[model samples]
Target: MTKKRIFLLLFSACFVFLFYRIYYHPETRARENHDRTRIVTDMKGRAFQVADPIRRIALLGGPTGQVAFILGVQDHLCAVTNTLKMSKLVQEMYPAIKALPGPRTTSGNINIEELINSNPDIAIAGDIDGQIVLDKTRIPVAFLEDGMGEGMEDIKREIRFYGTIFQAPDRAEKYVAFLERVMHLIEQRTRDIPVQKRKNVFQGFSPSHLVTLGGDTFMQERIKLSGCENAAETVTTIGKRTGLHSGLAEVSMEQVLEWDPDILVINYGKPADLYKDPQWRNIRAVRNKQIYSQPAGVFIFNRPTAESAVIFPLWLAAIAYPDLFENISINGIVKTFYREIFDFDLTDLQVHDILLGTYEFKMMKGIKNRG
Candidate 1:
């Protein structure tokens, strides 16, 4: 054969070999890895053997889904709860998330049929209902504790838990380090502020403005961590009963008027509603326009999420004590958070829109704007 023909044949053979190694080799290795299983202990202290790679996941809670998204394992999410589907942040950040199938219930109850049909390798649920899931689909269900008593630590653990589950322990560790750094910074900045000087904050949840968080809730810890005292701390009804009732409770308007918080933080109501209301006008927060709506990101900042564990304290501290944190750049913190955690490159406008909750996405239906 001619030397030219021999050279061309060698070149074609090399090209074909490279393509096979690049495409088929990795896929074959992935299949081999997927078949491997390992035993893991979930937050509920239950042990189960899960796929090594955990290629598909079903999230039973919105916050859990946010955690997965933050850990950069969202590509593995096969199914999510309806609440996550309704989240404005999720809609904006991952438009494709809406196309995924969701369970039937809105009350944290997973639909067995939908979950089975989705065919996730494992499932992460908010509550410890593993038997129900196991009985139905034979899928190992890992329970993630809702952030309540431990505050920031709980969120960090949740992040690390999922990180381990999805084989992204390095990413989880990085985020935990970021969380600890921010927490330490806030602590150092506000540590010396005396109890008497801390801002008294009232976190209103419902339209009635009567349902507020108690001291034991995550929001209360967030407030305290931000160098502010919860105004509703005096309310004895909250956290009195067991279960979820302890986190939130109803209070009368007279009781709130008595508390007379220095700052009002509403999770679901417009600023105009408080500013224009006759009863609220006399309150210190309303009179001074100190009422600030909690910013909603992947999950509501007022609520618990890994993102909120870091971001909420910074945002609240800046608002509560501006002079002390004047040197801290909240905008920079937010920009870095989105870039690192969500892997989304946000422009200045996008960052502002998230902070202000005015990104022009559809507001969660039936939920009033707290801004």
Candidate 2:
């Protein structure tokens, strides 16, 4: 054959062989099988595909990691933010998670290089910045709605979504059912309490800045469910701004004094300082020592968590209506919650410490400390 013809033929043969290897070879076919995935529409209405058996996951923001833990799928987590690692219950239950690498913020702001290096099949992000994850990484990103300001239905929806993604729908449904039962039981017990009898509550976020729970936020719902009225429900603006917002609403100390709340619930400040502060001495809660600190578990009780949805209201109710819920033991409830959701048994002393806000995992030097 002519040299030109031979060269052409050889080139064509090589091209065909490369094409087959790239598209039809056994390795390619195996990869195609592994890539078999399903579409999931997140809370923000963004749709994305994830691997069929999602083995490794990166949780960005929101309580996606916590929800995953609740659904019994935390074993799939490969990369988690610093917030998840800092969770007292999570560290206690899964010590190995302390070594995972990722970002630290809950706003879906992550280290792209570390995240990509982690090789997570999928990334779940909070609704606020999920799009950033998609823009920055080759990994598939799914967004979950902000659970903090949402209701129980939203929590259940997130639970079901995580369950479906992890192929654990049954477990998800069981948790949702448990949440429903707990919510219903609290409602049934406190539904008929007179409004006049319900305590007026002030939720403190800090010492100098006294932020209270607004009526529209989930914290307000929690306060109401606990048979207490939010002292700041009437304030329309936060931090002197004229607009609605979720989470803590910054109010003046004068406004708090005007509301004159009967009970004080603090998340950031020390109860002792509040009680001793000369400026706060006149508040009813301070004089009576009705101040209570929000509990911290897998996550802070003040923030949203699948676990907190059940525990926060119940704990608050027990405190708000002690005469009615006197039979409920906060320690027992904490034990049962940890036992049922996490399958981690807690000693009575541990439960007591958790209630007292002293339950913390010994700080471990791990991925977080590494440069």
RMSD in Å for all candidates: 11.7, 5.6
At residue 105, what lDDT does model 2 achieve?
55
Q: Which ten residues in a row have the lowest lDDT in candidate 2?
A: 359-368
Off by over 4 Å in 1: 1-34, 128-131, 236-246, 358-363, 366-371
lDDT of 2: 0.72
> In candidate 2, which residue ranges exceed 4 Å CA deviation?
1-35, 104-108, 236-246, 359-371
The pairs that clash in candidate 1 are 239-246, 269-370
Candidate 1 whole-model C-alpha lDDT, 0 to 1: 0.75
Model 1 C-alpha lDDT per residue in residues 231-265, reported as the tens digit of each score: 87765444454333335788888878888888887
Q: Which residue pairs clash in candidate 2?
A: none
